[model samples]
Target: MHTKDDWITTPVTADLLRGALDVERTEHGVLPHRLPARARAQCSDGQLAMAEAQPSGVRLVFRTRATVVELDALPTKRVYVGAPPRPDGVYDLLVDGRPAGRGSVPGGNTLTIDMTTGSFETRPGPPGTLRFDGLPVGTKDVEIWLPHNETTELVALRTDAPVEPAPDPGRRVWLHHGSSISHGSDAESPTTTWPALAASLGGVELINLGLGGSALLDPFTARALRDTPADLISLKIGINLVNADLMRMRAFTPAVHGFLDTIREGHPATPLLVVSPILCPIHEDTPGPSAPDFSGLGEGRLRFRAMGDPAERASGKLTLNAIREELARIVAQRAADDPNIHYADGRDLYGAADFAELPLPDQLHPDAAAHRRIGERFAELAFGAGGVFADSAPPA
Candidate 1:
């Protein structure tokens, strides 16, 4: 039996955390980072830095008999000057592997980004508390999933009863890397992200390294994957490379091989699945360095347009079609010796047909319903019988 005054404060530590590659002890609290310090030190890209700290799939898990639990966190919210106010990031609570509660922390730092100018400003704000009351009233597993889009710095955790770090759930860890789609771009909540949903359905611990605009085949990202412990791994490539106009087919081919080689150095036999980009009609045939189409901004809408010259395709500029073909060839060549390596066509996950039914609201990121569809399809394709990762290990 617990009383109102029996609040126990638990120190936030790596032992009680999951899905993050590193945890930084800030002066105010602990900040979970998807990219480790060494990797971050190698790149000074601000966009990548921001995306990695968003904690797409990170969560704190513990066991306690407390009926009430409170978490103190400072979440950095992104605001576009002319765009509509983005919804507050939602924190999801799971008890005994079941959805128990959900709430959003308010009053945090604000990052005002001006996409038109490619500039931004930050304003500091105060930390807020998230509370969950009236649990089942006995010792049980509790997982608090942080917001997928907002940058969160955890301050403290309190409960009516003392909490203990939850033991490993015996699930194989799935390390996944991709672009903003995998980073939960338009996801409604943390747990509702495609990766989160798929991990839940597949019963695996998730380490999502989906660094929005930064999944550009950087060696450091590959090295980060190499160092992480994972029984299953996936790389979602193509769209980011095309949208950023980062590389052509010539450089792209070698970069893909190098990325896989780096990971193979550590986990030669690990089940690795390479997934191409989900369909984005605008970039499917056209090359890009995508540009913002802010014509709709006045109406609180934002959109994108491919700015790459179609003529550049003759000079080897990359498009989704080109990428898919090249990736299939690369995987086929490697599969001869690397039996664990597999390729999943992105179209299989979301094709032109899917777009017709559930169109991308902003002509880019998927909406909440689309996220659910992708998650369900992924579970069936990648985790079901005869799937690439089907025999890796039984679900936890």
Candidate 2:
């Protein structure tokens, strides 16, 4: 015998007893083809029903059957090169068909995109997906131009939902810098980038400045980080520098210090985490192109060589071990003055032991499965219990 208010107020109550469980279910048949009408309808009338959008740049969203809203991120314009003569492929970007940007994928699988001018050049991108972002807030029509070899397929589009202005300021920001592995290379979607994954898990807003080939201790990048706003910061170094053979011990040592010193200029007391490169065979003790072979025929058929002898690393090259040793020494020296600074060996997130079990298919970038493993490990080590980062709190 309970009053109406009593029944409603019960904290741990059974809905069945109250007859409030009028469960209703409906199964909508899947629709095949690009730009499903329903999705397009949601985008019509210059209205969008989405979580977020960028008024002036490309916004990427990743979804899968397991998780409908899998991941999303605004594309970072910074690009990098892996090998020379970068591959040549179609550069397709359409904003109502006026040509927002254009570039061809070169041979090295490199990418160079100019955000300000809306231009791009990169090697052939991974296949089987298409995305567009940066539409004017009230776009009603969209025309696309495809690469010579590609066909434009409208996969999906949605107008962003209006965002309510927040009354309170957001939490302290965390800025991170890293390589392709951090740039979501081979990640199932743009949002699955390890940094993004970790950020979501940590509940911190992020400024991911992961430039693929460009992470090699560049002065400009250091300057950029120094100028940016951040309360917590991190730099995932080593692999790219090793693979690119960008500098030797003579220059590498100073460059590392310079990068850190530059960031400290802006964040004198902010917590900074320096992450070593994760386990990458091609660049781990072994010089790059660790193993290479040729098969098939024609110009596009011959594969480049890689994976040389690990013992040869003694010849003044940047290897993972070399970077690790140097980073440890550098951090130890700096830690004396900068107590807020921290160091995290990338292997702590994904180590040689894990590599033995889950080798990167390309011997460079981790595949999708590896990305998940790395993401989980990163979330645990960099953002888990007793971790240095305190910016991210579990969502309420």
TM-scores, each model vs. reference? 0.98, 0.58
Off by over 4 Å in 2: 1-169, 289-312, 391-396
Whole-model lDDT values for every prediction:
0.93, 0.52
- Superposing every Cα of model 1 onto the true structure, what RMSD results? 1.8
Candidate 2 C-alpha lDDT tens digits along 1-396:
323233211111111111011111212111111112333344332111111111111122111111011011111122422222322333433343234444332222234634334466645432232333444554233322222111111222222332111222264566777776775565654345576567657766556666554477766567667776777788998877766566777888898999888888877887788999887755666766333333322232323234556676677667888889889889989999888877888887778788888877666778777878887887787677867775352321
- Tell me the lDDT of candidate 2: 0.52
Tens digit per residue, CA lDDT, model 1, 1-396: 666566899999998899999999997799999999999999999999999999899999999988899999999999997888888999999999999999999999999999889899999999999999989978999999999999999999999989999988898889999999999999888899999999988888899999999999999999999999999999999999998999989999999999999999999999999999999999988999988898888787888999987788899999998999999999999999998899999888888999999999888889999999998899888988878878654432
lDDT accuracy of residue 213 in candidate 2: 49
Question: What TM-score does candidate 1 reach?
Answer: 0.98
Q: After superposition, which runs of candidate 1 have C-alpha atoms over 4 Å from their true positions?
A: 1-4, 392-396
